[model samples]
Target: MRIKYAIPIVFFVALVIIEKENNIISRVSDKLALKQTPQAPIHTSRSGNALPKRNVSVTSLGKPSSAFTLMKRHLEKYSEHQQAAAAVTNGRKDILLLATTRTGSSFVGEFFNQQGDNMFYLYEPLWHVEKMLTLETGGTNATATAKAYCDVLRQLFLCDFSLLERFIEPLPVDHITASLFRRESSSSLCREVVCSPFVKGVYERYRCRNMRCGPLNLTMASESCLLKEHRAIKVVRVRQLETLRPLAEDPRLDVKFIQLVRDPRAVLSSRMVAFPGKYKTWSNWFMNSDVLIDDNEVKKLKSNCDNIRMSVELGLRQPVWLHDRYMLVRYEDVARLPMKKASEIYKFTGIPFTPQVNDWILKSTQASKETRGIYSTQKNSAEQVEKWRFSLPFKAVQLVQKVCGSTLKLFGYKFVTSEEMLRDKSISLIEDFL
Candidate 1:
């Protein structure tokens, strides 16, 4: 009886050792995953008394599973897959602007308040949804995720929102907006205001900012700022042409447009440092990012510019685009004499410039002059804006010149030195426009 029991006990001990070894093997395999963080390392150190440094910041904010990370690794791969057929468009009737990025869209939008009583300035309509998420969670992960989503939304909605009318409504009847766009009223506040095709995409992207859909409001909405109103005529600046195109195309709107452009070299040099790590960086939210173009990225961005150019150029030539009225502004010019440009913009849009509007433009322009685009004569306010000549590197400067030289030349920018001449074929591109 003693021999039989002893034999069984010896077998059980052997099994326990094997099971422990299997667990150790499993832990080893789980660590060092490419897409995921490894488990907490054992706390042993060479001195035995000290533990290793562990970066728990990631874990504290909810470290994704290694499997989730692996799945994310392949996310970019599926980006090329064909999209399902998009839905048809629902039309909107509002004044709109057709233009590109790095343009004075914000400033131009400010000009809209001067257009008249019905005018409403939907400032950074696309940015609200972004602010929504951050305002919701009030933490690092939420902020980071919100920003990334905002970038994705902006990039994905590259085309004018009007083009995808089926999937979206330009002036969606949300709680804050419902008052302006009641179904029973043919003369609703939404129609009264110059809603752009750009509004829908931007609003959709920023919708996250307002879960109560709180007025899709601004941080400064209650600052008691007066309207830069006109009795008649409505105009608004739109930065995204794809969004502007369809909205301006709608027959209900007596749309008037303005296309604003800036120097490409100035554009790139000005933005490189503002957002160091491309769209992923939080710093990019305010600074210009166009200056970091390489050969391929230049190709993509230039294609975007070209599409904008054609759209605006077509609108200028035809009465059908924006009800046949349009104007073009150079951001460089506006930076120098914002008051002058704003005055001229009011005239071109057929609105009487009110004292309030004039004062607003002057004050806003003056206050923001230092930090506005460095294309004008104002001295650099930051190291990032100043190093345009050096920061872009010679090759990147040439790439910008090669891709967007004509657009700059059209705005009367000249190459100042021999270095610029040898590489910039676009030096001659502007003479005809001049």
Candidate 2:
């Protein structure tokens, strides 16, 4: 019985030793096989740009697996993918400066233009597109029209100005905006304002070096141009808020709206002085001079007033404003307190208030004795805030007051009668008009 037990024990011990040796040989053989195997080069995209190869742990089929290791590897890859997607998505921002002409939009546009490399600004890109779209749809098919506009706008946001080529072909450079089709045109005021390497390269690529229009550097994609963090446009041609509603609601686009307004009286004064009708005809008066506006001009004025009212009402209807995604800025207020208002604007838009912007504000707003042009680009505060108060005649003031009285009151501008105006120290009568 002892001999039989001893034989079984020896057999068991020998079997265990064989099993251990087999395991050790298997691991050594597996490692040698891995060492002898050649690694293939990672496949890369045709563009020649590729992400680095991930470090993957190698294992033999016979090796025991751990659920924890597998899960950790999977979680690491998932986190990397997520981070890449977020990096691509988080790089873009869209801002629309919604305002009418002669409402100090140019001045306000400068605020965005000064943001250095982070900003890509287009001044009035939609001015001609709005006209073309209006003619094509002709008040019918509102959905199609808005969609068409949005489509073009999307391209613009992506820095694909080539889409505007067809629209710009028939019209002369004077009638149609050249900047929409050709990047180096006067409308790319930022080329002058922001002369960074990126801006310079983009301008060289997108700009129609020749006056002729076609694909501008097809090799340079829209995505490349849109690599900047902020893309903004100051548009005056869009007639209704409805035209922009789709963009505001698009989940893919991170969009914000800024409504820039001026005192109606100021707007009227600026328009009249800039372009006045000599014969006192309605067309001439409405287009040319702000002095002695007749009944016909009043009708046009009322139309402008109605548009403003409708726009404001529409803005109020949108819940985005309540969520801090929308802002209303007055030209007077911005001119009066630039830094304070600029800080507010910067805070709202999530842009840093850079020293360059601060210096611009300080230098631009300094009162100068230099006689600047009526529509000079140089920032002049005294002229900007209340020029109409001094230059407009008593009769012209009264007419503007009557036409835009309700709008004035709504905007908190105190109405001053001709008598009340004459009493103020700043009032200078236009004797020729009187």
Candidate 3:
């Protein structure tokens, strides 16, 4: 398995999982930052459907069962750790809201953060871990390689530099950095980031005892990072379909996963503005040729709208995990009907739902394919979906329509007309399930 293909998407997506870690990439290139800025927000939506809620228990180690637990733990621990408690609850069903760039993830993740008892609305942990794994393994056997990568995480939690250097780009000097590095020093951030969990966790223990570091810094490093509030979920709310072959075997993270998708026309329409005039639009992304590239070529870009769509469709259809456990959600749906979306998530976790979460769902940015005017011809009763038809030029819309016709139809989106179009569009939904 030369992973020659999926590796790029995997490594790239790992960076997406923990966006903050890309502080490394951010430091290096503004171009990279442009694509990532959209992903900086936090959160997810739970579908609000009625169902039998499963049994849940908070662990003896004082673990949180819902998102709120993680939130309270951090806020109580430090005044500065304001928002972004993690989404996982300890000894409880892990709630993972698969978020894509700019699909109102911040509003959704934040909503859950406020609702759950044990959830920590922390920055995207998946992105951080993903990038770390990719850098370490180049997307080869991501599952086996990332398992080894977990030790590095444990080290950072403890702040043990003994082997932490191996995870760093150039490594760092320990005692020298501690003594010479001034407060808020560049070296300090480097040290803090590279340190093992044990080293940092214990050091945080010392800080809690002392009065150094601001309330925010202390809570973020110590309480949020060290406290036994919420346990990490076995979730990989990750993209990058091909590289996931290795990850598919990890029983913890392998259970069920979700992918966020949007119409390529809409994706390119916004992305055109997101990037500067230089190579900005789909034209720039696609080499600006009048001729359009087919699906096979799009998959090579990995991050491209068409590529991600194919990957998501294929991953769902051919999962290493079981069907009963696997799931999928649309980014547009998450933005449109958050409560309904959140309710679906609650079902996946097999947890109970509360009115409080339901009410929270009513509140959202209300930005989706519907409101944003991106549409599917399915008789789903369109509210405002169809952004591409309205926003993009006739040529751009036609280009996306021609190239992505098959993908759109596979997901149940209807083409304007023509038997060939519909046949090309239809996906193996039954094959995907049966």
Candidate that would win on TM-score: 2
Please write out the lDDT profile of model 3 over residues 1-434, one tens digit for every residue: 66987899899898786674444333222221222333221211123333222111112112235788777645544632221222222333333344455443444444444444443333343444445446654453433333433432333323222222332222223211222112221112223322323333323211222224421221123233333233222223344454444333322232234455555555566555554463243454355566554545344333455555756676667654535544566545655566677788657655566676665555333334454332211112222234334445555555556767765665555444332332332321112121
Query: What is the overall TM-score of model 2 with all chains considered together?
Result: 0.63
The residue pairs that clash in candidate 2, if any, are 272-290, 275-288, 276-288, 276-289, 277-288, 277-289
lDDT of 1 by residue, 194-256 (tens): 222233323332232112232221111211111222112122222234444433432223345
Candidate structures ordered by lDDT, highest first: 2, 1, 3
- TM for every model, in the order presented, reads 0.45, 0.63, 0.47
Which is the better candidate, 2 or 3, if ranked by TM-score? 2
What lDDT score is found at residue 11 in candidate 2? 97
State each model's CA lDDT, in order.
0.41, 0.58, 0.40
Model 3: number of backbone collisions? 72
Ordered list by TM-score, greatest first: 2, 3, 1
* lDDT for predicted candidate 3 compared with the true structure: 0.40
RMSD of each: 21.0, 24.4, 16.4
Which candidate should be chosen as best, given lDDT against the real structure? 2
Backbone clashes in each candidate structure, one number apiece? 16, 6, 72
